[model samples]
Target: MLVPSCENDGGDSKIDIQYGAVINIQKSSSSDTYINLVALQNGGDINLGFTIDKAVGDITSMDVVGLYIKSDGTTIFKGKFSTGIKTFPYTLNINKQKIYDAFTQLNSSDDFETGDQLTISAELTLKDGTVLKLINDDGSNNFSSNIASSSTYKVFQAYNVSCPSELGGTYEFTTTNVKAPTGESAPGPLTGTVTFEDQGGGIYNISDASFGGWTGLYGSGNIARNVQLKDICNKISYFGVDQYDEVFTFSNLVVNGNKISFHWENDYGEYGDTTLKRTDGSNWPALTL
Candidate 1:
């Protein structure tokens, strides 16, 4: 059990890392076609994002511009290769709502596969009339594949957010070569911005101050909520304990996050695994066209 912030006389426990508001645009199923927005921590970082699990990169190099994603409640373009944090000249934060909505409107007509490469190479003409070039170690190609993306969707980060500034705002999105997978290239490139509203509170504070505590966490911990995802669920277990290289079994399980929450058996016990409850109400929202 975690010590309550109120009971911490030693002042060792702080509170949940506070962060500015940030939005998350995510879908329900890997193949489901819908998305919804959620807020980042209250004075914390935006650590959630979307990933394109499988991509055919030979035809889709970094310079292939005209690709964007609508996850995390914002519209933004991620380069073919990135740190998932930096996309060259800009930082990855949820754009303001006004901009986000506009771009999403334009992209509403866009058709995409569930797991297509999100970025590609494009040409930028400089004031001097020189087209921006893609770089290569051998200087043979203008683009290269980035190491940051994986076959599975991973988190994109909106670093160090705060209260008022990160709230409702606009965002921008661009796309190019947005063609069906069976095609040679995408439907040209679409570059534009979108505007959106901060639909919900941008942050959630788990603090003892709200309840008079002195620790990093303040609320009652739900034993069932110990698991938040599949991996987290796999980590917990209870029964005739056995220490494998890395394994655990949990009892009375609960999962939390986004909208959906549930659990089952820990791969042990009799008719066992885990189960879910809708006590908190509402499952994660959907976003897809």
Candidate 2:
């Protein structure tokens, strides 16, 4: 359960959009445990928020209000008072064209991962100018589109991911002081000829770094960043921000001929945006996965 604080990480992010509906919990003859949630939807930003009182459970009552104002002051989609989906917790899914735009807004943030809770509420103006809340927790409810693939997205900038074939020569990698996110590039010159030896069975020697994971993943995260000469296997992929607790592995890189290339990144980022580095290309800071 995440406590609603006045800060995000170290940066304080707060809002006053306490409008919409509320989830009131009523057990068998028990006190009505009202769960107050606040959702601050930025007018013209790529981000939105859902704040709920508890990490779990559903709220039966409360009318959620929402507006579907378009570019020309026209309501593209309209809705009245509703209840949240109890099974899906705090998510309100309107099965209309506006659903596409809503997805774009939700996917703008980089915090889409498992265990991350998404609560949704809406408010509507009645004919009498009265505000009402709607939506309830149900299985058919969808807060946003499902995020498939654990593969991480890497952005490039200063140093881009390079392949051995890109070097077009036999290059060697030797690390003097290995580090994370930042460190001195190895084998003397930052730019030089690179070589890749494909040893079949999910194993490749990139300069001094080895990459492989099980089931197209070569191995696991433990074998990726460390100096090892083993063909480890892992069936997992993950995204990393600030720090990566999961392993990133490469696979099935065979050296049929010479001039083989290896793509790698020293990507380190946060929630808003993640940038990557490319090997001096048309785009300085590009996006890589």
Q: Which candidate leads in lDDT?
A: 2
lDDT of 1 at 256: 45
* Residue-by-residue lDDT tens digits, candidate 2, 1-289: 1112243556766643332222322121221111111111222221222322222223343344333333232223333324432342343233223333444433322312122222334433333444443332221221211111112210100100111111212443221212333332222122222233443222234432322211112212323332212221211122221123333333223231222223333333110111112233323111122
Q: Tens digits of per-residue lDDT for model 1 on 1-289?
A: 1111233558675555211111122322222121111232222222212332212112111122223443342344433323222132222222223123433433321322222213222333323443443322222333222322223421222221112222122322222222222332223222232232332213211111011110111123311221221111123112122222122233343334322211222332211121222223443222111
Distance from true location, Cα of 47 in model 1, Å: 20
User: Which stretches of model 1 miss by more than 4 angstroms?
Assistant: 1-110, 113-117, 120-272, 283-289
How accurate locally, in lDDT, is each candidate?
Answer: 0.25, 0.26
My TM-score estimates for the predictions, one after another, are: 0.19, 0.23
Consecutive 10-residue window with the lowest summed lDDT within model 2: 154-163
